[model samples]
Target: MSTIVVDHLSKIYPVAVKEAGFKGTLTHFFKRTYRQVKAVQDVSFQIESGEVVGFLGANGAGKTTALKMLTGLIHPTSGRVEVAGHIPFQRRSTFLSKVTLVMGQKQQLIWDLPALDSFKINGAVYGISDRALNHRVGELSEMLSLQGKLTQPVRKLSLGERMKAELLAALLHEPNVLFLDEPTLGLDVNAQVAVREFLREYNQRYGATVLLTSHYMADITALCKRVLMIHQGQLIYDGSLDRLVDRFSPCREVKVEFARPYSAHELSVYGDLQDVEKQSARFLVQQEGLTGAIAKILADLQVVDLTVSDPPIEEVIGQLFQAGTVAG
Candidate 1:
């Protein structure tokens, strides 16, 4: 069964006219004009249970707005949204209790209190049994390495530490569905990797359905096998991450490692060299040309090793966005 189903969902905000100053405000109180801004327009998709899907779009593309609708933080202007067999906008306690939304830029933990206290508060709100709460907290804390930091005030914890704490709080009730928006934002490289690893492990262990939205391609690449791309509130693509790459990614990048240093003129006969070093050169080759490119390079030089791979996910997404903007 599908964990989430969205049908022709749309969200529109009324833009209120703001006066320049006090005098202007008084003059325009009776003559204000309102503009309609459509944030999400006719977007629809379905996510199967236990599927890890990436929701991708550039800024102002309505990713966060859609997430809010799915989590019952906000109601949709029109259309339907169903999460875990319940209408999310209804804000039913049963549905809310089974889902969690985590935003990296937002904090649910009190700054002055320890994360443990915040977790306890959430536990109370969810009506978790004391014994189960403790066990769940212990498991999540151990998984996220929050052993010592849970007792520290949130303000005293580092960005990464606090993020881990937030994850613990969100998962304390063992939510079956998760909506993560930029959950690794502002985290250092190691911290980002740690969060990514934890998410992967958690998904595997519990078979939870997750929909993640992030500007960081690494987050999507590592956590999602399927990706949905939206542009200007329109669904543009939805399929395997590999297929997204195959359809939009420029081409495979061929890196040939040389046994010895070679000049550029010697490599140009093969393909467009993207980067070069004394003993290695990277080339951009079309999918059809990859094998031939490798063959020609080996036939021409003392090549030690060769590697071929799809263009980076970021580049693929950039191209997708660029095409979208141009089409608009």
Candidate 2:
């Protein structure tokens, strides 16, 4: 079953227009001019129950705006959205209880209070019984590896610990749908890995549906098999992560470490030479020609080692955004 559905979803905002002059300011004060900014335009997609999908976009690409509409934080200017069989903007009690939105840049915990206190407050708000709340907190904290840290004031915990605590609190109600925005933002490498592991485990254990948005490609690569790419507030691509890569980047990077030095010109015969440093060189070779190119290189050149890999996901997505258009 589809846990979330959106059709032709869009949000537009009006911004007051003013010129850089006293006359313009005086006129704006009495009769203002405004321009419509299309933050999101005709975006549509569906996420099945228990699916983890990545929402990809550059800054100001309406990723957050779309999330807000899906979470009942803001009403969309047009189209339709249903999460867990409920209209999100309605903000019904049953709907709210079935979904959770966690933004890394925002905190719901009281800074001066221990996170456990905040959890209790959230429990009260959700009408969870004392025993059930305690059980849920204990289970979630253990999964998050947040043992014994909830007693400290929120401000005293490390950023990673606090992020984990936030996850625990958010999951206390066991929402069936999770909308996470950069849950690993500002986390160190180890912390990022930890959070990713926790999320994977939680999803598996609860069969929760997750729609995650992050600037960190690692988060997307680690957690999502399918991704939706939004450029200029429009969804440009939606499919498996591997398909997205194959579509945008039809070539693989082949790094060859030679037994002897080779000039860039000499390496160009094998493929598109990317760079050469001492005895090693990198080339971008079309996937169709990869096997033939490797055979010729080995047969003609003194090669010590070679490795082939897809272009980094970040680079591929970056290029896609730069082009600003993808064939539908």
Candidate 3:
């Protein structure tokens, strides 16, 4: 069964408008005019329990708005949404306890106090018993490599450590579902990898469902096999990461290291040359022509090395967002 479901969900806002003139402004003050803007439009998808999925979009593409609706932070203007068998906006205790939302740029840990102190407060909010809270905190701290850091003031910890500690506080109750928005936002490479590993292991250990969004393709490619892409207030794509590339990416990249020097112009007959250095060239080949292009290259060119790969995930996704619709 799907642990998260969104059907025909939409959120709209009305903003007052005025023409660019003093007379227009005066008239608008007397009688206001408003325009309706769709922040999210008929967006829908489902996630089975224990699945890790990436939510992707450009800025103002409605990804965050959709997540907000799912977590009960904001009500939708229309449509139905449910998480863990409960209406999200209802904000029931059982539903709240079963789900967690973490925003990478935001902080919930009390800055002036040790993270341990905040955990106690979180425990109280969730009605966790003293003994259970202590045990849970200890276990989580060790898992996050935060055993000693918990006693230090949150402001004293590094950005990465603070993020890990924040995760500790958020997961104290062992929520069954996690909604993560750019969880590695400002983290360094190693720190980002650590968080990714932790999330993967946590999901595996407890079978928790996770919906993660990140600007870093590494995060998406590493943590999620499936992805959902939203653009201009609508979901444009949803499928396995590889399927996304296979569908929307109409071209494949072919790289050839020539045995002798070659210019891009010289390689144009073989394929649409995209780059050329002293001894190498990269071509963008139409998928349908990829095999024939490779055959031509092998037969004609003195190639020292050759390889084929799909376009970069970031590049493909950027093109999709720019096009404002999914295309094959």
Best by lDDT: 2
Q: lDDT tens digits, residues 46-160, model 3?
A: 9999999999999988989899999999999999999999999999999999999999989999999999999999999999999999999988777788878999999999999
lDDT of 3: 0.92
Model 3 worst lDDT run, 10 consecutive residues: 319-328
RMSD (CA, angstroms), candidate 1: 5.0
- Ten-residue region with minimum lDDT total, candidate 2: 319-328
Q: Select the stronger candidate by TM-score from 1 and 3.
A: 3
> Model 2 misses residue 182 by how many Å?
0.4
Steric clash pairs (candidate 1): none
lDDT of 3 at 221: 95
lDDT per residue (tens digit) for residues 1-328 in model 2:
7999999999999989998899999999999999998989999999999999999988988899999999999999999999999999899999999999999999999999999999999999999999999999989888888989999999999999999999888999999999999999999999999999998998899999999999889999999999998988899999999888887897898999999998888889899887899999998899899999999999999999999998778878887888869864
Q: What is the descending lDDT order?
A: 2, 3, 1
The TM-score of predicted model 1 comes to 0.81
Between candidates 2 and 3, which one is better according to TM-score? 3
Task: List candidate 3 stretches off by more than 4 Å.
Answer: 15-35, 256-281, 291-306
lDDT of 1 by residue, 161-255 (tens): 99999999999989999999999999999999999999999999999999999888999989999988888888888788887776676578888
